[model samples]
Target chain A: MKRSLKQFRYETAESLHIALFQIRANKIRSFLTALGVIIGIVAITMMGTAINGIDRGFDKSLAMLGYDVIYVQKSSWSTMGQWWRYRNRADLKTSYTEAINRTIEDNPNSNLLVAVPQMSTYQASVQYRDLTIEQAFALGTSYRYPQTASGDLSSGRFFTPTESAAGTMVAVIGDDIATGLFGEREAVGNIIKMKNSRFRVIGVFRKQGKFLGLFSFDNQVIMPLGAFEKTFGKKGFVTLRVKIRDQKQVDDAKAELLGIMRRIRRLPPQKEADFSINEQKAFKSQLDPIKNGIAAAGIFITGMSLFVGAIGIMNITFVSVKERTREIGLRKALGARRNTILMQFLIESVMICLIGGLIGLVTSFLMTWAIATALPDFPVQFSPALVFASLVVSVATGIISGLAPAVNASRLDPADSLRYE
Target chain B: METSPVITMRDLKRHYSMGEETVKALDGVDLEFLKNDYAAIMGPSGSGKSTLMNIIGCLDTPTSGTYILNGQNVAEMDDDELARVRNREIGFVFQTFNLLPRINCLRNVELPLIYAGVNPREREERATEALNRVGLGDRITHKPTELSGGQIQRVAIARALINNPSIILADEPTGNLDTATSQDIMEIFSDLSKAGNTIILITHEEDIALYTRRIIRLRDGRIESDKKQ
Candidate 1:
């Protein structure tokens, strides 16, 4: 057994050397054959890169939503944009946040942390002296708002508890709001006009990029909920942001919050609550199917191109076998077994594919870099796993394409092949 | 005491079916060769000499009768087993000097040992020794394309002898060479035979057959004569 294994190794080594020599001697033919694999690998790697970029961008957006936070609103994020289901539902009251927070504070073992009630309107406008910014997101929250969110204060401070309770006309402005209304001027302590009332800009938030390249977090004006009610009306859009003790316990936290909200609404035991409890995971569940759909379609299309490429390789390998008939006869006469001939052809095709795969990886890496440099917002990534997966695919393609020809070469009659003109 | 023959054939037959007709390529032929025998098979173009060479080289199987090489009945062997028999028991020299043109002389000579599963160091050593024996020791690194016809044939012969097989089979070994280079190749074969290597070759030229100690003539797939000069 050991001797056979040693012999197999020697034969494989000899085949590899012969394959290399054949490829080197026929450089143009080899490269042209390898081009099929090159195109296939490039398509595969680029597809993988695109999918990776989409995932990376989604993860970034999820991070901005704060993984540890969940939201209580009228419409669920998982069923997002299905406004008809939530249209007839009553608005989620901001006062429910206080009740939830009170229960969390009393229970020592609760997975719930803190809840911040938020009210906002996108139609609100802010004016500072002669400059005005329209369609700015005007939000209302309390002293605990920063705990459930991600951004940090760039200047001044959030409203103190006493100020929040007093309904003081003090606000924390977003980076875009501050920059738009003041334009490099000190925004803190500056008073801005909104809806016939003046409110002091107590703080400005650091710049936070957009979510999924759509909604901007930097364009908001956050103030005390009580103060926002007098200006934007009490019935404006409302959401309750709840911070959980651990993100891993989000399901438990959501269940706990659901019970709390049901009690706040005084719902009967048999009746279901009208509100929705949501987390970042809801967005994932909603988007994952779409993402998978894109991936499945991309893979099929890419697989088709690779299949065409493999057929090309198979055709070229057949021609190669036919061209080397005399050499095959000679080798067989000298002592090459059927398996040795098969292995020689197989190694040749596989070597070509491996080289093609490496070239494709390097090409995709450069293309990814160039794309990132040209459009910094474009989501595209090159990963080592992608490299590994594509190489395996290349090798499989080589074997699948080489098998028929190699077998034909192996089965050639040594005596007859020697006599072939 | 007389020793047993290294090669023995009993009623070997190879027939080809040609469109409803059976062409008897080799019909009921029998032969024997002792160890260190130098022989040539001579016949005309459709005389079954090539068929005999094919069967002797283990490249083809006979339809009937047993062929025993060194006491092993190789007639019934399967493809892979026959390959092993060829690798271990036979060396082949062809008319075209069938050296792989891309590889150097040393690599070409090492081809048989590779199939025989010899390790690299030993394969190189044995191949070098065989090449040196064939008088191409200085041209080990030269490709077939770089060497003369005589040198290429010597490389083929070295490859043939690398495994030290029981029989060296050459088919029309000098048919494509000039008279002078043919003499050189025959002289190398002569030297190999004198050194106790059993050698067999097939050719139609009597002058080429003169180099071997014995010659067998075939006609219409039957042995016509066996003569010793």
Candidate 2:
């Protein structure tokens, strides 16, 4: 057994040497054969990178919504497009925030922390001098709105409770709004016009990128509820943002909030509450299927390219076997076993695939880097796990493609092959 | 004193089916060779000499017969066992020299030892010594394409001798060479035979056959004559 093992080792070494020599001798042919694998690996890695980036971007957007906060509104975030089911429901009242807060204060064991009312519209237009910004998200909320939202103020401070209650003409502007109106000048103490009303900018929020690449948090103008009511009327959409005691205990908090909301709406236990309670998890559940669809399509396309590549390798291997019939016979007569010949061809194809996979990885890395550099906002990430997976896939393809041709070479008749011209 | 035969064959028969007809490649033959016997097998075309050489070299199995080589029953052995027998007991020199053109002379000669699982250092040492014995010691790193026809044949002979096989089987070893190069190769064989290596030559050329001590002629798959000079 020991002797046989030694023989196997020697044979394997010899086979490896032969494989390298063959590949080196046929450099152009080998590269062409490897090109298919290269394209396949690139497709797979790029798709993986895109998917990873999307996941990261989604998580970032979700974080912007505040993990410990849930919203009570008329329309459900998860089923956002089917608005007819919610159209008949009574519009949520901004007064619900006061009622919810009172209920929490009365109950010492309540999971709810505080409730802040928000009213917003996407059609608001703001102007400073001759410059105007359209499609600005104009929001109205109390001074406690900061507790249920992300992003700290980059300059100045949130509105004081006295200012909120007095309905003062003051506003907190987003980074984009500040930049659009004031440019290099400090935004605080500057007055901007909204419709026929003039409001002083008291604070400027830091830049936060788009939400799932759809809505931008940096394009909003926030003010007190009384000031917003004076500028845009009370007909705007309302959402009651409720902060929770702990993010991990969100289910308990949501159940408690549902009871408070039902009592506030004066609904009996039998009737379903008219308002929908939503969290970041709703967006995740809604987007996961689209993400999975993209992944499935990417895999099918990558598989097809790899299949073509395998066929190319197999065809080349068959041609190699046919070309070296005499060599096979000669090796056999010199006492090389059937397995030795098989191993030689297998190693050749595998080496080609491995090299191709490495090249593809490097190419994809460069591409991801270029994408990240060219468009910083575009999601594209390359991970070590992707590198590892592509290499394994390459080796498996080599083995699968090389098996039949190698077997054919191994089983050739020595005597007849020797006589071949 | 009597010695055990190095090779023994009894009632060897090999048949092949060519479409609707059966071609009897080898029909019932018995033979034996003692150690250090230098002989030539002579026959016209289709006289079964090639088939006989193949069976003797352990490249093919007989349809019905017993062939014993170096005390091993080669006829009953499987493919791998036959490969082992070929590696350890027989060294074949082909008509075209069969030296792998891309590899150097030393690597070509080390082929058999590689299969026998010899270590690289020892394999190189033995291969160099064998090449030196064949008068091509200085050309160890030269490829077959760089060597002359006579030199390539010598490299093949060196490869055959590297494992110290029990019998050196030369099938048309000089068929591709000119008269002068053929004589040079024959002289090398003569020197090897004198050095106590049992050799078998397959040839139709009378001059090549005349160089051996014993000659056996075949006609139509049967031995026609056997003589000693």
True contacts kept of each: 0.69, 0.61
- Number of the top candidate by lDDT? 2
TM-score of chain A, all candidates: 0.91, 0.98
Q: Among these predicted structures, which one has the highest DockQ? A: 2
Clashes of each: 0, 0
lDDT (tens digit, per residue) of candidate 2 on A1-421: 9998889889889988998898899999999999999999999999999999999999999999999999999989998889998999998989889999999999999999999999999989999999999999999999899999999999988899999888788999999999999998999998999988899999999999899999999999999999999999999999999999999999999999999899999999899879999999999998899999999999999999999999999999999999999999999999988888888889989989998899999999999999999999999999999999999999999999999999999998889888878
- Return the top candidate by TM-score: 2
DockQ (C-alpha based) per candidate is 0.72, 0.79
- How far out, in Å, is residue A356 in model 1? 1.9
- What shift in Å separates residue A42 of candidate 2 from its native position after superposition? 1.2
Q: CA lDDT, every prediction?
A: 0.90, 0.94
